[model samples]
Target: MSSPRISVILPCYNEESYIANAIESVLNQSFTDFELIIVNDGSADNTLSIINGFEDSRIRVIDQENLGPGASRNNAMRIARGEYMMFLDGDDWYREDALEIAYREITQKDCDLTFYQMINYDDETGDIYENDWFNLTTLDELDGKVFGPEETPGSIFDLSVGVCQKIYKSSFLRKINAEFPEGIFFEDMPFFYYVYLKAKRISIIKEHLYFRRKHDASITHVVDGKFLDTVPAGQVLMRIFIENEWYEMYKFDLLAYKINGPRFALRYIEEKYKIALYELIKKDYTEIKSSQYYSDFLENLGPVKKKFFLDIIASRNYQDFIKLNS
Candidate 1:
């Protein structure tokens, strides 16, 4: 009945088979002073029945109509009673020490947000993969190259945007009014960019404490959808950055757009929209001298992956790129 130090918010849809294991992973965590808030986002399956079977007082369940993951997470966050917050997806489970380790690191560093790495697992094939998604040169290296509130420009530079990997201070969350945008497929991209910019200090742990399951039903595994939708969603975030005069961040955004955005737009035009793929190419591909980041991105792309899009941009071979599209 005592107040908990951290509140773990989980948003569940139709995840009956997976929710129980996800909950148990937290309950069995080496760190136990945390409450679990599970939001059943209008599941037609047995997700609710399974959640109700849990007899723990620390587990609080909220039932609401299907409102997308972002809104569900925001709803739970509003009623969260912990000093710190962490997100655990319904279909994914955390390592026994994830929350424990993240809590310790955040407090020790006095960081507003502390994030770590993730190990991705394939549900069907049992294939396992791990990477330091943050691209941290060293996990043990901290305190140096730290960014102050004013010194660091806001950017879309991080490797992953899964909200679940980090622990956030409740006060800091309130200041930014941090909530994922609702009804969008790529909601986290915008949410992370905006919130990270507002934070006074941020930190990262180099260890992998989270296990991300790559299930076919999950949005992440739906490559076709992501390939089609991510760019448009990223474009919206780009506009938000530009309108705010965070010009320095544009380099990061442009890189993101070039790397992932074109695939989404091109996929949409080809499969669903049935529009001319050539026209989807930037009509005015003039250089924008905003920052070295952007210029560096172009230089990096010139000799790299020889895709139709790159060929068009690099060689001005619009005809060739268009021919490949056909």
Candidate 2:
């Protein structure tokens, strides 16, 4: 078969209930030159069966064991025969013109990657809500111009740490050897930073081009031991910054993230699982206290936030962590 102009990869694991919509969205896209690569990550449910239901000449299916989405994307990316690529989650669908719009901008403006907008779909309520997850004003300020990683300070951390919302040049990704961090729940954070740091130029569009499903059972909502992966996931992010010689420029952000990120994760976890999470956070936070950036973080945190951050770490147990915050 001839190479496709664009390759769209959909990765899913037991997403039987939502896979069909995602498949249809790609099949029904206004741009027809793209190939759809569906990675069935060992779904135990009817997800594979659902994927096979579609009849499209452009569709390619890869059946693999239950590797995480990171591995799924990495595996698919290596084999994709397209000039450009984008990712789609099994539970989410794209706007009909998403590929067309993103392709037009990426090609016309000659950017390494271009990310459009996204709206949240609350599966429970069927509500489609606007999410200004990125600083919208920042994009507006760019005024349709392409900007490099250095052009925007700390931009590697500013945008939504999700890849499904962006379209990347296949060659640029290959050139930089961008691979998602595998075997982790929050791998997207590290991979996102790694790419932005290597990206030569990128564009942003205000047009909403994707629907991100939000539901009770989805990965984002269903908290478990996997949530603890955020710590190591963050460690990966820090290593990327340091490896790229960006630590001094963004260390304050990293220190603040160390302080606030885990707290946010623990808040939603069941009280039963809070202790393990606390132990991990306590160890992580305690170990990093000696770093000058840690001291810089506390020094600049001001009185109120400092006390709040300290109180979280100083807790004797998860209960005290809860009670102190409460």
Candidate 3:
């Protein structure tokens, strides 16, 4: 068979309840020239069974021991045969025309990546929230808005880092060796960060092309030791910036992201792990502060944010910082 126009990588773990719908959504897409690579990361539930129920020739299932989403995606990419690639969680469904529109736009412009909008779907209440963060509206407004690191340095940082809601050229990813770090939570941030830096041209499409299901089982809703992976993920991002010598150019954004790690731990981590996580945060913060870019990042912050950062740095106490921010 000839290579498909797009490869949709859907990684699943214990998603029996939603995996069927997810697979059905892709199979029913208006665009048919795509391969749906479903990676079952050792799901204990009926996820595999549901995936097997799909008899479509385009659907390819890979069953393996649980290695987490990062590893599953990496494995899928190794075998993917498509001109472009897109990611979709096993619990989320795409709009019927999502692949059709994204494929058309990205191919027409010959861009490295194409980012579209997505709706946040609340499964409990069946409420759909439109994306307002980017304020994207009309096709004409988003058309031909191609940006690169040199043309608009900050624009890459502004775009959402979610691997979903975006389609990437297979060649671009392969050329840069963009692979997710296995066993790490929040791997999307670092992976997307690397892609943004390497991509020569990126285009934006204003249409909402995906439905991101919000549920308790999702990573953002679960609280556990794995949340600590955010620290290492941030570290990987910083290391990438330093290694690429892009630290000086994106220091402020990187610093903010690093600081947000501890802030997030303080707010959401379970009490049992808070103390240990705090120490990890402190060590990372200290190392970041000693970097040459730290002072520059601080100096550029506005007065209010600067004071807040100083207070947190000086306090060195998670509770105290929380109280001050609260």
Candidate 4:
């Protein structure tokens, strides 16, 4: 058998209701020279059975114990045979021409990786919502930006994490050994940042190429009384700040984390500060305090923002802190 142009990986868990449609979306893609690898991550539902029902020989099913999406993707990448790899979540579906367009850019333009925008769909109502957060519309706008080299890293950190909406040359992925951290929530932020920094050239296609389903089951979703919610996903922001040494990238993450910390802290302390959570943030700040970067962060925090931090420390919860802001 000839090698396919792209390998599309779908990591499924308890998505029996949606897997058939997700599979149909990929099988129906305008580009036929692609392989689909669906990793069944210990789904208790009929997900595996539905996947087996597919007649396409291009689809390969790999059954494994539940290890979360990050690990499931890692397994798929390990055996992927295509020259390029596209990771899609099983519950979400893509536009017909997404792979065709992305692969065309990669092959013809010699771009290392290409990322496109996606629509957000409500799982309950089946209504599609366009995404506001991802800006994938124009590649020409980012022309002059330079990534350092293959060995040294640059700072276009958004590309690595959102695997589904992006196309990556298999050779580049092999060189970087890209994989999300297992057992961790928000695995993409770190993994994506790392991969983007290492790539020679990255492009963003602003078109909406995929539909990202949003509902109760998504990792990004928060629900009450669920173990995925109640269980400590830990303080991911603080860990990122402390573990990563790239200051340029560090500053970008810290700027966001620091701004959001007080809100997290308010939520943490309000709910009865877990000794673990408090230590995570305080220790993270303590470790980075002496870095000139930390001082730079403080100097850049405008008076109002500084006051907001102080208010968060003084007030009870986010709502009270908002009242203080008003």
Per-residue lDDT tens digits for candidate 2, residues 60-129, read 9999999898899999998899999999999999999999999999999998988788888899899988
Candidate 4: misplaced stretches above 4 Å?
137-140, 143-161, 223-245, 248-253, 258-326
Q: Candidate 2 vs. truth: CA RMSD?
A: 2.3
Pairs that collide in candidate 2 are: none
Candidate 1: C-alpha lDDT: 0.71
What lDDT tens digits, residue by residue, belong to model 1 across residues 266-289? 544335442343344444232323
lDDT of 4 by residue, 1-326 (tens): 98999999999999988899899999999999999999999999999999999999899989999998779988999999999988788888989998998898777767677777888889889897774465442333564343233322223432224667688989998897777778755555556656665677766666788888888767656422222211122235334445555545456434544556333443534344443343443444455565555666566566765565455455555456558766
Q: How many clashes (backbone N, Cα, C below 3 Å) per candidate?
A: 1, 0, 0, 5
Error of 3 at 102 (Å): 0.9
How does residue 199 of candidate 4 score in lDDT? 72
> Tens digits of per-residue lDDT for model 3 on 70-144?
999999999999999999999999999999999999998899998888888888899988766533343234466
TM-score rank order: 2, 3, 1, 4
- For candidate 3, the per-residue lDDT at 127 reads 95
Models sorted by lDDT, best on top = 2, 3, 1, 4
> What are the TM-scores, per candidate, against the unseen true structure?
0.78, 0.91, 0.89, 0.76
* Deviation from native of the Cα of residue 15 in model 1, angstroms: 1.0
lDDT score at residue 47, model 2, on the 0-100 scale: 95
Give the poorly placed runs of model 2, Cα more than 4 Å off: 134-137, 154-156, 290-294, 300-316, 319-326
